[model samples]
Target: MTHRWLHLRLAAPLVAFGDVAIDHVGPTRDFPAASALTGLLANALGLRREETSAHQALQDRLVFGAMVIRPGRLLTDIQNAKLEKKDCGWTTWGQPDVRTGDTYDSPHRRRRDYLADHDCRVVLRLHDLPEGPDLDRLAEVLDRPARPLFIGRKGCLPSAQLFAGWLEGENALEALKAIGLPGRAFWPAEEGGGTVRDISDMRNWRTGLHGGHRRVSEGEIA
Candidate 1:
């Protein structure tokens, strides 16, 4: 079956593909996570953080594959900040995230990893559902999102447009190769053909937690 796919170019000065984080150390994967891609699409559709059900539904419907057009260098950022109980920080939802604890004499610190000068291409299609947003809707919303769209993180903004047109293929892997942009690629295992690896990238938005592992094929798609 020939499936229609939406093409997205994720070229950014700094791109952070989320990984399983422990404590104050936040790591990034080489390619985008399924959860992160879902969040990006939800944001483009103007879904709020509080809209857990909507986010969950959208995530469940997403099907995609990604290719690293440029293997950018990994950049690590060490951050430290001291804050008072009354201090508040801005959020993407247009609300202030206030610090609830007492004033801290010491600085709160964390390490974050980002991909610097990276370029990636994604081919996405939605599962056949009775109702919900489709590929055309996603492309439209991404072009003129209700809110500003960011790649992975808010500070890691895209250097180019997210929508790169469309492609048709038998599966996500086939669609990716049709682009003719060679690099390491990752796709759902069921799509067939690659080194199978178990990855925990899905998220339970309702509980705000990382969920079970899913199999993916990782290999070069030249």
Candidate 2:
């Protein structure tokens, strides 16, 4: 049987600018209800901010739900229910019946193939920016030359560095950051190591995987 999971939804799109956007769909904590999984997935795929073609297939799901796919698999022809507040049930990209998998490896290849066909890539600009329990704490932790950036929902796009900027009134760095890290996953560490691993081996020196690194800055923080 196919394993299933649900995530919660939080926050909404606040702004959109040029190519990048911002959204407040992060979870309140680590609850298990619904999540911004689809949003992240759609965003990652570099789907044009105005594209709604795939929204119906994965809306109102949790960020965690998007990670349910096995590594190196594609998820295509996947369809969703026509209603909200539901599981957003899914099917294969091309086939009718649920694309069944035999072993865990089966699902991985399937998902990888589906994503390849649809050209999926997650966007994570806001997540790349700094975020902590509080802005103050976040500010302290994010005082590096590397400007703060994150993934945005819809309306929340970075323009003048007004809200999600290092300085309150700067745009140069904002624009530069936008070009550098257009996607969002750059912010949150993958579950295990790459993208969907359950637990990352902090001591995986061999793989060069460990604790997170601060986005370095050009000059000293002013």
Candidate 3:
């Protein structure tokens, strides 16, 4: 039995609209990508650490979900792809709604159009391994960076589990075997990892791009 490790990448932080509200709000109150990530991980993986400790650790390490989106369509196209039952290679990780709010500026209008009604945005970005998924194609079509970070520092849950699956086409189990995770252990472990903690605790809401937000200045993640 092999266990598989799926690494989800998350952007920095930003504001997000949610039914729940935080104590005080500000540009800094933008979603705490790190904090939310920790909650998600704890819920997904069912870590043994205390809630507070896990939250702090996940935040400090800056771990979160990842998605590969088409370039100019980072906002709109990705959403459409997802809406159309197409996979953006998104994980069960956190993402904000990009259709609302007045805080984003992109060179491309398609992205603006898609995000026009959503209020959530990405902040920082985490890289994914090439073999992990082909966000490259999505990036190429958009003629922009393949991977994009959420700029809004916020959080919302849409029950979007399109990315979660029992398998990843073509016996990913074989890949896990090659990687040394026992096959029998793979599925259960992955499910456990994805459902480690309280989903609500992972809520985040922060928007507004600060000078710190950055795209892939280096070459794409081949």
By lDDT, the best candidate is: 1
Q: TM-scores for all candidates?
A: 0.94, 0.19, 0.25
Candidate 3: regions farther than 4 A off: 1-4, 7-32, 43-50, 60-67, 71-155, 162-219
Computed on alpha carbons, the lDDT of every model, listed in order, comes to 0.91, 0.25, 0.28
Total clashes for model 2: 63
How do the residues 1-222 of candidate 2 rate in per-residue lDDT, one tens digit apiece? 211111111222222111111241221211111123333344434445445433333332212211111122222232222332322334446644533433232222111011111111221122122321223332333333132332232322323222233222122223223333232222223222233223221122223223222221121111
Between candidates 2 and 3, the one scoring higher on TM-score is 3
Candidate 2 segments whose C-alpha is farther than 4 A from its true place: 2-27, 31-35, 60-222
Ranking by TM-score: 1, 3, 2
**Models ranked on lDDT:** 1, 3, 2
Could you list the CA RMSD of all candidates, in the order they appear?
1.9, 19.8, 18.0
lDDT of 1 by residue, 1-222 (tens): 999999999989999998999999999988888899989999999998999998888889988999999988999999999888898988777899987789988999999999999999999999989777988999999999988888888899899999999999999999999999789999999978899999998999999998678999999976
lDDT of 1: 0.91
Give candidate 1 misplaced runs (Cα > 4 Å): 86-100
